[model samples]
Target: MSLDTSLLPNNIFSLKNDEFFQIIKSLVGEGLCEILKIQSINSAENLIATDDIFDVFKYDSEELIDIKNKHFFKLQNGQYLVKTGIKNSLLYILKLLKVKKEEQESLLNNNNHEEQLDTKFIINHPLLRSLVSYYKYTDHIKNNNDDKRSFLKIFIDNIANNLSQSNNHFRYHDSVKQFAAVLYILGGKNPGEQKTGKKTS
Candidate 1:
């Protein structure tokens, strides 16, 4: 039971311990204080109520199985994975901030900058454009099972090459390349690498 300090006198020394404890029990009901074992010295301890405690066996057995089943659901689809890889690849090209870009020279020359250049196109850089192209190509090959693994290897290799051209780009790029390599090794074959198995999605 938590006591309201305001209920007690500002000078606690004025009241006896017994008087303070009686006032505490009166403010909060009887059993509530019994749930907390208050000592004569004003120090209290919680006594775990063994009689009213819940038993583990009281829950339905099916509830335990339902919890175990939830672990099997994961989000890793081929199209989504490819899209994510392209996004990560684009991050290496430039520092993309939330700020929007606008045409400066044309706007200064005349107010009609809209006729000369698309304002939204200012955000498009070479690297981002390349990544967008790769993402679209990956989506295009969704049904062509024959060369899926090859497609992924080529995509990852392209990113790795791009990283190599820039200063220490491959440092972070190598990790992604390694991931792609692992996936390739673990039944991650190109379109023609494996002929017998069902195609990966």
Candidate 2:
């Protein structure tokens, strides 16, 4: 069936401007991605216990409730029917990455072509989210190893072209300034003086 964008779940929307992204923020890295992938395979059941998911993962009620209001329907028995349509296409990509057995820069950048952010998908894409979750689960044995950090460094390096300050990926200082500006305004300092941190007597 062809996807009508209007009918698809909020999970597939751009994270930069989507409120659903913020609501589900608590679930990321806590196995919400894993549960979604598992549910994607069994299109028949379509139901899961959020409470039981904490058996292997962890979450508080508020975190669960936040996503529940948006991405799940509460059944009479309390199981959640996932509202997201995680199709076979996602499963195929997960399987393909499994076959690779290691991170590949080929998935990162096309050196033959110019890099452009507007022309490409954001880092929060469901597709990339699934692949990252797949690699993380597969590499569970090395979770605490120093090599894992090295692996991340290598992964970042592989896509470093897109992570530059010019691309809005690695402008750590700008973010710091923005954060400081918020604090300065909250402190009731003069806007011009906030930049220089000077006091006028």
Candidate 3:
């Protein structure tokens, strides 16, 4: 079924300039990380060109051109680069995911059961799926004791800390909460009740 864009806020397409930049930066960084996993590259110093970033994200030429025109990306001497460092890039992605999760929950709450199904499909869009994949990859790294595991742990801790500080009782989408559950299972424990912060085996 097609997604119901009408449910989204009108500002969805016209995000603040800074917000738009951060989203694209985060996406590019995540895409590069996936490419590094595929190529077995351990060093972050190796610069990724525009074509490589596009390939990793499976973006067609038209999409690439569109993104460039939107000023969310800059191609410098044929290489794609984010002004924000990798850590910030990752944090931005986490922030974006949190926003999406809350948005999805709000839509579900205000809609009928039949309409909620359409909301679920919209929440499963490719961009969110890619974020889920990134988290899954991080979980794998943590499990296997990879060299990058320490960095991934720090990233997760940063996200958790931020969430704790927000003090907002966000109702995340079911799939997003399920992903959190999977991460907990990978860490050898059952997931807690997210709202209550209590766990049961």
Query: Candidate 3, residues 162-186: lDDT per residue as tens digits?
Result: 6766558544544445667889889
Cα error, candidate 1, residue 198 (Å): 45
Query: Which residue runs does candidate 1 get wrong by more than 4 Å?
Result: 1-123, 143-145, 148-201
Kindly list the per-residue Cα lDDT of model 1 for residues 42-132, writing each as its tens digit: 3211111132211322344554333223322223441111123223322321111101012233445676666355444634567556656
Q: Looking at model 3, how many pairs of residues clash?
A: 0
- In candidate 2, what are the lDDT values of residues 131-194, reduced to their tens digit? 5665677578566456556555455444554455465564344434565678878998865673
Question: Candidate 1: global Cα-lDDT?
Answer: 0.41
Worst ten in a row by lDDT for model 2:
42-51
Mark the regions of model 2 whose C-alpha exceeds 4 Å error after superposition. 1-60, 87-93, 102-201
Candidate 3 lDDT at 118 equals 64
Q: What TM-score would candidate 2 get against the native?
A: 0.22
Name the candidate, 1 or 2, with the larger TM-score value: 2
Candidate with more favorable, higher TM-score: 2 or 3: 2
* Cand. 3 Cα-lDDT: 0.49
- How high is the CA lDDT of each candidate model? 0.41, 0.44, 0.49
